[model samples]
Target: KVALQFEEDWKERVYDRRYVALAHGELPKSQGTVSSYLKDDSHYVTHSSQEDNGGKFAVTHYKKLKSGNGYSLVELQLETGRKNQIRVHLQDLGCPVVGDLKYGDGSDPIGRLGLHAYKLCFKHPVTGEDLKFTSDIPKAFSAVVEAI
Candidate 1:
């Protein structure tokens, strides 16, 4: 039997500032890391902009990889995985993922969530060996990125 462990590498997301502007949300003027605290109450996970809040500590780092007309292709790394961590953090950044109805402005430019896990790495549970897996970006995602 194989016991898989989660070791986050990075995720590809499309951040669209247009949505934030349309929704009257504040947009982050800078990009680097987000160390916001989060709390999961089953129904929803909320975040406190403060660092010392009594919520579960979550950290996500992001950088702009490419720019589009009104959006950008971003690479994100999660230091601490939590429920809806990426989505929540993106929302906090005011550049929610395109096609993310729950977090963004209900846009579906790709007809699916604009989030993809392209790589995963883990250690073998029994042999303690390192293993890694990778996959190509979906055609739909690629097309959208290309068009944007």
Candidate 2:
């Protein structure tokens, strides 16, 4: 994992494209996107000496890509690397990642957690070199999104 930074600078970008299991209502088609700081919860805990005052902040940006009968494909950019940040944020959004047993309704539509990292960009700390890597969205992901 990349070095965790709590600042909101967003210098390190981790973009994920995932399928979410929607409930009774679907995401607003016209809204296009949503972003906010993730509220602190027990899921953010880590092996550290710092006290848990519930002030730790995490930001996530979401863009709806497609809507199916009971699911939606979304692109998410995490500004903070808190543990389970994406899952927790999506859970709070009311439509958790599909197949996420800990956060969602545990609907295993894809037979696994519907989260995938498609891109990662960060500056090397010591060399100050810009580093970036990207991968194709999984075929299973595309199959699910296309069904929308």
Candidate 3:
């Protein structure tokens, strides 16, 4: 996954995290590696923030949810330009993009990730209409909203 940290230049860093099921109790003694530590592993999977954290999922735009379920903000301009980049990234972090059981949270109540691309504000590519649109948080996100 590709993520940019908060610092000078804001150079983006990319990691290739994948699903590796541990054999029985083989989970890492440390929840994650030091590299992931610098990237905030524990909460990275959740829809929260990466304000000084270090872990695998470093790209911050739509962070893990930190509190009562409500909505999530997503900026797709940085999409890795790959199929399932977002879903793969979030799943790698352990927090499958909510309703996307194929990625992170498989225990979906309604269906789909508890996340959404709630806002889309930009100027028309040609018309320059300063178009802006927003979508309500998916109801699936609400059923487990309080979990976060």
Best by TM-score: 1
**Which of the two, 1 or 3, has more lDDT?**
1
C-alpha lDDT score of every prediction, in listed order: 0.59, 0.58, 0.36
Write candidate 1's Cα lDDT for 1-148 as tens digits: 2322222322212121111111112235435787777875566746555666668888877766555446656666677776677778878877777777766787667667777776656555556566676666566644554572
Residues 1-148, model 3: lDDT tens digits = 1122223222232122222121111111223321111222344433323344432333322322222343232222332223344555444444444456444545555554444455554444334455556665554444444444
Selected candidate, larger TM-score, 1 vs 3: 1
Q: What would the per-residue lDDT of candidate 2 be over residues 50-142, giving only the tens digit for each residue?
A: 234444566666777666666777777755566677776666666778777766787766787888777766566546566677776666655
Model 3 ranges off by over 4 Å: 1-60, 68-80, 113-115
Inter-residue clash pairs, candidate 2: none
TM-score of 1: 0.73
Residue 66, candidate 3: C-alpha displacement in angstroms: 3.2
Instruction: Give the poorly placed runs of model 1, Cα more than 4 Å off.
Output: 1-31
Residue 41 C-alpha lDDT in model 3 = 36
Predicted candidate 3, C-alpha RMSD: 12.8
